[model samples]
Target: MAVSFLSTVPNLLPIVPVNASITSAPRYPTLGATVRCSKIEADADNEERFKRRSILTCFGATVGLELVRSSGTFVEMAEAADLIQRRQRSEFQSSIKDTLYKAIKENPDVIPSLLTLALNDIMTYDKASKTGGPNGSIRLSSEISRPENKGLVGALNLVEEAKKEIDSNSKGGPISYSDLIQYAAQSAIKQTFLASAIRKCGGNVEKGNLLYTAYGSNGQWGLFERNFGRADTQEPDPEGRVPQWDKASVQEMKDKFSAVGFGPRQLAVMSAFLGPDQTATETLLATDPEVLPWVQKYQRSRETVSETDYEVDLITTLTKLSGLGQQINYEAYTYPVKKVDFSKLKL
Candidate 1:
């Protein structure tokens, strides 16, 4: 029998709340001391460990920072950071960078491609959740604006603003807000993915050229697609649509996506596929030793731990327990799927 794509797993994974209340908190300086060593040995073994730890911290901080900064906004600093990191890591050939730059500059639609990807993923997830369907009178803007959304909200806002500009410039031509928001959201996703990739490669957001193609560059990821001409609606969706980050269970997450018309397969794929990015704060604290203590304290106050530390610790623990990187490998895999063409569908 073919695999059922819509069926939920019997034993769902528990949602570990990052921001739960803690009974006792460690002092900031003490927490910082836990991760920091006083002296650096120039020995081979120590050097190797130092390099690994540095790389891990860099990646973790970048992801955490991007998450915090981008939460609920569209202006993408993460994209800029991704490009810089990519360039530093030499992930793309110099020739490829040159080409991408040319394409972005010549084609205004290039940025929109990234936006579309981000939007579609969220929309797809939303659609998959039985509890968060489009027909339930939920507001798109409100849902996008939730605090849990973090960096995504800003990206959505950018989409809304861009749609207005397009409509106004069109001199009464049809442009939908939905289409624009979708595009922006997808772009944010692309940015996040690229940023995440950079962190994985031991780079940070300071580098700009690696994050985005310089305007008018060629050889980008794909061809530019035209907008479907959707307009924005000012109305915010009623409450109870977006899932609380702290309260979300695997089942609840699935239900939220189902409500938005997405399926179990898509949800599973997304869970595995989406690359993580850091918040701005995470990046700053990780790279600078002076700020590490403060960051730890702040996180503790919020009943959260450093996201970067968590990612590394979780991966390390799982690898040790399993004696294989299977869990890590699975989490790293993403679905190579194309964006949904809303223009072709009768919405």
Candidate 2:
């Protein structure tokens, strides 16, 4: 989807389909562009994009895997939500969706511009190093200009599109743009996990069957849910909120996340995902030579180590960074889903 905007306007980005999953949710009766909300059929092509939010986002109408995986659109989303309401799925799995609804019903105004940083896994970060700059600075215009954030404009503009549609259709009550954007992201994560669960067990996808996420080395987390209610901020986030990968060393990244209640292992997990996915393997080495080291060890380990063992280790550490046991909900900050190897899918 594309939005035409005057060229002279600064900081106003044109809404384009940067990430496919975040397509237009369309206003009530009319069909918007075939944005993420478009009612699409599920198939193999969709599966490749549907599986992971750490890199890209894809949208589809149904939820299933023929030979692989695919995404879920409003239709499948409604079905899964209905199933969850009937207790077939855990309430925890629907936290993201629930939060969006709650945000719209309560403080609808904060919906737009609130979900900017919700997608920490977006691979738009540039390799530019900035150790010399302040860590948590929120210079809006300058922030967007940073090399690390080069490709993020597309998602940024999407915030406006989601806001426009949801607010217009808000007769049931308006929804802020941020709510829809956050919903789209969280929706992708929930659907991908649930889709994989259905692929494995061949039953209704819900907390009952999707509780495969292990918490501690010996214990397991019943489900993954993200909290909501992030209010929109007038300025960009402070510089230090996200890791300064281009400038900071691995230890710095660990320290930064650790300062906010995360640990080194979780930092490692986040680092593994920051690899430039848009850069192909042929060019990945040269595109960002530094990234390979962080993920290389894990990928190489995948070759010799048991895939389950490696994955379990990653998930266990990820529990900390991804809010494994934290008491977060729609009224609080949500956990970020670190990338997991989707290749292990049974399908």
Which digits, one per residue and each the tens of the lDDT, describe model 2 over residues 1-347? 22221122111112324333433343332322222333322355554443334222221111112112223356677676555433412333244355444443343333222322333422222223311111112224566556555554554454445455545533223333333443544433333334444554456555424443431122333332232232333444434345534444555555555555555444443433342331232133323344355455555544431234445555544333333122332422222335688898777
Q: Indicate the TM-score of model 1.
A: 0.31
Which residues of candidate 2, in runs, are more than 4 Å off?
Answer: 1-142, 171-182, 188-226, 246-248, 272-275, 278-347
Best by lDDT: 2
Task: Point out the worst 10-residue segment of candidate 1 by lDDT.
Answer: 324-333
Alpha carbon lDDT of each predicted model: 0.35, 0.38
Top candidate, metric TM-score: 2
Alpha-carbon lDDT of model 2? 0.38
C-alpha RMSD (angstroms) for model 2: 29.7
